[model samples]
Target: MPSSRHLIGELESANLLGRGGAAFPVGRKWRAVAERASGRAVVLANGAEGEPLSLKDRTLMATRPHLVIDGALLAAEAVGAPDIIIYVGAKHRAAEAAIRGALAERSNQLRSRVRMMSAPDGYVAGEESAAVHFINAGDARPTTTPPRPFERGVDGRPTLVQNVESLAMAAQIARGIDANTGLVTVSGAVRKPGLQEIDLGWTFSDVAAAAGGLARPVQAVLLGGYFGAWAPVDEVWALPIAAPSLRARGFTLGCGVVHALSEDACGVDATARIMAYLASQSARQCGPCLFGLHAIGECVRRLAARSPQASDLDRLSRWSGQLAGRGACKHPDGAAGLLGSALSVFADDFAAHQQRRCLRRSTSHPASLQPVAAVA
Candidate 1:
């Protein structure tokens, strides 16, 4: 086995980035913990797939629990941390059970060092700071930064909170393998929506095809989860999935979600529903997040229902700008990103809705805006 330094060096060489949506360099994160003077540290494997459209994390935990555990243990050893905590969403009972079963198969010493905890079921509850706060205070809300988790986390020690997939990749790197593939949850309007292990260079259309292709032709794809942006089908279907490539095109492969919106599904209506959910998921810690998001959600809902006044669109646009960079976490910014992208990518749809001429029939009862139920 390679030493921790060698492991981190290999991660850097392979350019492994966090799969937890942030895409931070994995090697740099580990080195920060290893270099800290405080030898007291902890490792957290985040499997709280709180993003409603994402199922990749829980799917990995269920199908390959050992790999996730291996990655967590490897990270614990690399950072000189004696304890590892696998944080799963309370709703993900199967993932929890799989992890516990995986833990039981490890050596007594390894089992003693690693434990599992159930996180609250909410979007922000999976944030790194929120996970640390929950471990320390039993509250899963995001706190102010500067004393970031890496600097002061669980029990006032440095903490490494990594996504389960990122840790899985780390485990592979430890075995002298370069990280090139990612797991994407291809949901929404697909004939066979499920988890897919795809190469970074695969085009969006290729991933859709691997998922048995679309059940209906799509107008746009919601890349990433709710926190991610939208892209017109014409623009994204042939685009590469690599982070740098997506970044250059003003997109992120966040939480590895690729949701398609069929032509019959009004992009405006779907975005409105997601925006409302995002608003409700806020920690309500800041004014911009609390008030700004709610206001934006209401405006989009009106626009989607074709009941918006002429000024509603302008108001939504202005609020999107006002809410950016104002939240304690990135919740507000992400909500803004989703709404802004919808307005831009589906401008024609929005215009049609404004004139009470949506292409799809609006359901008499709006679809319930709730997080996707946890799957086994």
Candidate 2:
């Protein structure tokens, strides 16, 4: 294998970011693992599409299994990992089958060092630390971090847990292919809800138009998945899908999900449902997560139900602010980010809910993944 420096430098030049929501720099991550690995590290090709509305990862794995395998092999070699694990979600049968079959066509030496693991289905199961914890303990829940996966992971060896999409892009860059696109999963009230490979700097309108345009009047867009914030549709329709661009505008391209919220749906109601879902997915490892999330969910639930007491609004605002940086993992932070964004994005509706004068809207589809047809 070539020196890790070469691949890492290429990735840096390409300015690659992880596709699994965090958008961390790919080169920086690889450089860290390369530094930590002592020929005993493990590489995790995370195909665990545990996020409810996101299907870009599995879409890539099922459609281009070889691409994923190539990236994983490259990562193992570059990071000095002797073994690689393809962690596909237990429910992602097609993706698992694709990779399994792809591996069968590879060389014997490559096949022997790689293994497949069933990732438990949950929002947190795909998290890097949780993925490691699952491999070690058979329980796919997040553990507190200090010794991150790169420092110490499976079998007490440093591990590199890169998202499958990130791996694929790395492979593309390695092969001198243009790696300037990001896969975004578009759903909710779109005429054609599916996964599309978007140019990183394309405007949101372009992505939406590619999804067959809007099926209804969209009031706002959930720019990121549950972990990301929401912004008024008009306010962000011109913002580029690129992470740095979105971040400059006080938003993130979280998990590459662009779910359009219909004017027929209530953002407060939608947010409440998401809050409850995130709360239910908690690992129950710490107080802030176990209790605080439940409390926050209940408050939002009351607001959504149009039965909030006066103090409930104040509590929701304050509690969400206090929830960040307090959990065992980022689980609480995700919930906080969603709730905080809702408080701002749907402030008018929230106030309406408190005044018992809320308007009617269509039902929400929080888990509406639908079939992810890749944009050709």
TM-score per candidate, chains pooled: 0.95, 0.95
Q: What are the per-residue Cα lDDT tens digits for candidate 1 across 1-376? A: 7987789888888999999998999999999998882556899899988988788888889889999998988888788788889999888788889998988877574832888999998999999999999988999989998899998888888899999999999999898777999999887777777788999999998999999988877878888889999899899888999998999999999999888877777888888889889989989889989988888888889988889988888787777777788978899989988888998988888888778778665432222222334476
Q: Tell me the spans in candidate 1 whose CA falls farther than 4 Å from its real position.
A: 361-374
Taking every candidate in turn, the Cα RMSD to the unseen true structure, in Å, is: 2.1, 2.4
Q: Write the per-residue lDDT of candidate 2 for residues 62-143, one digit (tens) a residue.
A: 8899999989888888888889999998887788888889888785758329888989879999998899999999888777
Pairs with backbone N, CA or C atoms under 3 Å apart (clashes), candidate 1: none
Candidate 1, residue 16: how far the Cα is off, in Å: 0.3
**Model 1 TM-score?**
0.95
